[model samples]
Target: MASISFWTTGNSGGSLTVRSTAGLRGLVEAAGFTEVEDAESPAEGRQVSDFAESGPRSMVDLVRGTGAPAVLVSFLDSDVGFVEAVTPGGGTWEALLNRAVADDYGIPLDRFPVEPAVKEALAWAAAAGLTPDEDLLLQALTGSAAFAEELSSLLLVALGLPDPS
Candidate 1:
């Protein structure tokens, strides 16, 4: 089974713990990735949280330091950013996401689907008076418990894994 570690940004309230987090964990598991609790020390299974104050580079470093395939899910109100940690065999996550968007929505990488998605989602959230948190954006998009599942499914399809319902 392929292993994938998940990390999230912008958890201000100490609420979005990746391991026991409500929405993402189930989706990741459903997508068939064996979740590695501690990518830094795989055997230790330690819980890790990258603070918003640490910036994106810290998250990038954390992901790269893992030496294994990993996904860093950022919840900030940016252009639907998906970055890949440089691992031995895995290709760029940006390329993967672009291709997935192209395949699913016919929006090529050059067109940049993430920007529009983020814009639309944020606009909807703002109109609804929702906070621009990860959970809200995710819930706005996938209706709770489906964000990671949906994203993982897209990524799995990009990686040629069997699509999970």
Candidate 2:
């Protein structure tokens, strides 16, 4: 009954939440990890004050406290850099994007209308001195299978699980 929680940033400012949980579960199963359905929204009943004070840390703590793994998926923006502070170092949004585009991952960048949005987001992150990548951004825009698999693998590694499939 192992579980993982997926959280995405950059949705509060009119951006969309990247709903990749289903895809992640499939990839995890394909990779030989047990899959657990998230039957409820983890954010349910969370106080605004809790989120306001702790931000993504609260979500991580909540998920981990439930005896499950937590995966924070961040969209590119100035505030998105906060993911680096909460998670282990060097797991930058940019690094995730690069991995998604690498061999085997093969994100079809041209298949989705993600270029315009990603360009805007990258510019925003750069302006804030953050080197955010476009992988999650593309996923948020298109939810392509390649991006989904890339994201699932990233989360699996972050959760200290094997990702061979």
Instruction: Give the number of the best model, judged by TM-score.
Output: 1
Evaluate model 2: give its TM-score: 0.24
Candidate 2, superposed: residue stretches over 4 Å from native: 1-57, 67-69, 74-95, 98-145, 154-159
Give a tens-digit lDDT track for model 1, residues 1-165.
111112224322111112222233333333332322322221133222322322334323433344333334333222232333222243322311223322343333453334444444344334323344544333323322223334533432232222333
RMSD, every candidate, angstroms: 15.2, 15.5
Which ranges of candidate 1 are over 4 A from the true structure? Answer: 1-54, 76-85, 88-91, 95-149, 157-165
| Candidate 1 overall lDDT versus native | 0.31
Q: How far is candidate 2 from the true structure (C-alpha RMSD, Å)?
A: 15.5
Quantify all predictions' global Cα lDDT against the true fold: 0.31, 0.30
Q: Output the lDDT of residue 83, model 2.
A: 23
Q: In candidate 2, which residue pairs clash?
A: 94-133
Model 1, residue 112: distance off in Å is: 4.0
